[model samples]
Target: MTQIVILAAGMGSRLGRSLPKPLTELADGRTIMQQQFDNIRFAFGSNAQVTIVVGYKLEHIIEAFPEASFVYNEQYDQTNTSKSLMRALQASAPGGVLWMNGDVVFDPMALERAAALVAREQSFVSVNTAKVSDEEVKYTTTAEGYIKELSKAVVGGHGEAVGINYVSRDDKATLLRQLKRVGDQDYFERGIELAIEEDGLRFEPVDISDLYAVEIDFAEDLERANLFV
Candidate 1:
């Protein structure tokens, strides 16, 4: 069974939404979170265990996805993805967790690629090599082509880490340790970078750029993503 987590605790003020960002309705008539759930069910089948970390307007998400397990992040307003992810991992069972930023809108094939990686028990950061936005989470690989630097501040980045990622069962403990070590305001990538630097965690950059994957942060991004939907 694949253990999946969605970080949906932020207010997503950038998107100007009164509701949770994951609940944003797309052109296809399904909300972003619903599409993510459907994509997971498609790739991982019925046994996939999904947990959502929620805070900002959590009630709407709970009402929409009542069957999903939830972990509340009371400090969501003060922290970032690192802390929200920490909460999920703390409550998780002994297994690798496949997780994504709640706002990503991607082709279903993306999760199929993710599912394949999970089956191999490979730790990875799903990447889109086609676009390397300076403002997005960028990554540079080691000589062995494993992820070396991963953050928005990366220099000469080869591509962007598209936010779909996994921690293998073996690396789970190490990642959790680093996540705890990260500051409250740091994104989860900081924890991964620390794990790689301090404990030598290997995270492969799985390229899924041929397939469409958009992280909805603004109205323009949502508009572009809707074209794929």
Candidate 2:
């Protein structure tokens, strides 16, 4: 079974408000995290099990998703997603894990495809072959399709990370140890880069043409995510 881990710990200072990013209102009355969870559950089928890594107003998250198992990161404000992921891994049972940023909103098919891809390949990330946009966070890829470099700036690539990742059990241990070795990095992508360099844990690109997801960063993205609803 594929375990889904939703990372929702950030305080969303970029949103320019005191509100938690995940609880930001959408057009349909559901918060962004709730929308993400609903879509993931639908894609994973009724029997799907989920783990939510929460901080930055964890009480609200706990109250909102009473059924979800939670892993708290007290230093969420001081650390980055990579550290939150490492801590969450401690509580997680070993298996293939489909990890998504909680602030990302997408159609159910994207999550379904991610699960399918991980089950087939060792591990993969949902991405796109479209031309890079100014708003896109990009990565550099080798001819063999393994990620050679990653950057928030523009670069040559057939794909862009869509924030949905599938990690296999074998790669999980390797990646986690790499993250630990590179402790206290400001960004999770940094840990990913280290893992790729040190342990050869490359993220395969799974084209997300027929499916879509948007990572909510600013208020504009919060407005944009409502369109999918």
Candidate 3:
């Protein structure tokens, strides 16, 4: 069974309100985090053991996904994703796992593509490439489709990361160790770069252009996520 980790432990201060970012509303009358959890639940079924890392307003998240295993990151406000994910990765124990950001909104097709790659035992990323406008998030790539760099900028002409990652058991272990090496200053993205450089873990970028993925950080993005519902 593939263990999926959803990192929802952040305090979204930039959202400019007290409500936890994940618990924010969508057009479908479900919270953003709830919608994502429901989608994942559908994709993986009971075999899909989900571990959600929560910190800010943790109780609300707990009540929302009672079936999911929970790991609280006490330092969620002080730390970055590298640390939170490192902690969640620890509690997850030994296994092949998929890491996803709690904030991204997308259709099940993206999850399907990720599952396909995992079924093949490959390390890959789901990305949006065809909509390579200036506003799109960036993911640098190699000729063979491996991501060489990733960010909102330097996004090559064709690919942008969709905030979903498939990891094998070995890769997961390696990533955890790298996470330990990352200082308190780093975020998850830094760990990804380190994994690629230090461990030769080339994340294969799987293009899913037709699918839309909205990452809600600010109020405007939250409003944008409404379109998906």
Against the true structure, whose lDDT is highest? 1
Q: CA shift at 220, candidate 2, in angstroms?
A: 1.3
lDDT of 1 by residue, 74-98 (tens): 9989999999999999999999999
User: Which candidate leads the pack in TM-score?
Assistant: 1
Residue 228, candidate 3: alpha-carbon lDDT: 74
Cα RMSD, each candidate: 0.6, 2.0, 2.1
The TM-score measured for candidate 1 stands at 0.99
* lDDT per residue as tens, model 3, 103-185: 88778778877788888778777787666657555677777768777655563456667778876776888778888898775
Please report, in order, the local distance difference test score of every candidate based on alpha carbons. 0.94, 0.75, 0.79
Quote the lDDT for 134 in model 1.
Answer: 78
List the pairs of residues colliding in candidate 2.
Answer: none
lDDT of 2 by residue, 133-171 (tens): 756656777678877655466466555778877778778
Identify the runs in model 1 with alpha carbons over 4 angstroms from their true place. Answer: none
**Position 178, candidate 2: lDDT:** 64
Deviating ranges (above 4 Å) for candidate 3: 131-137, 152-158
- Candidate 3 or 2, higher lDDT: 3
Position 175, candidate 3: lDDT: 79
Candidate 3 weakest lDDT stretch, 10 residues: 150-159
Instruction: Report the error of model 2 at residue 5, Å.
Output: 1.0
> lDDT value for candidate 1?
0.94
Q: How many pairs of residues collide in each model? A: 0, 0, 0
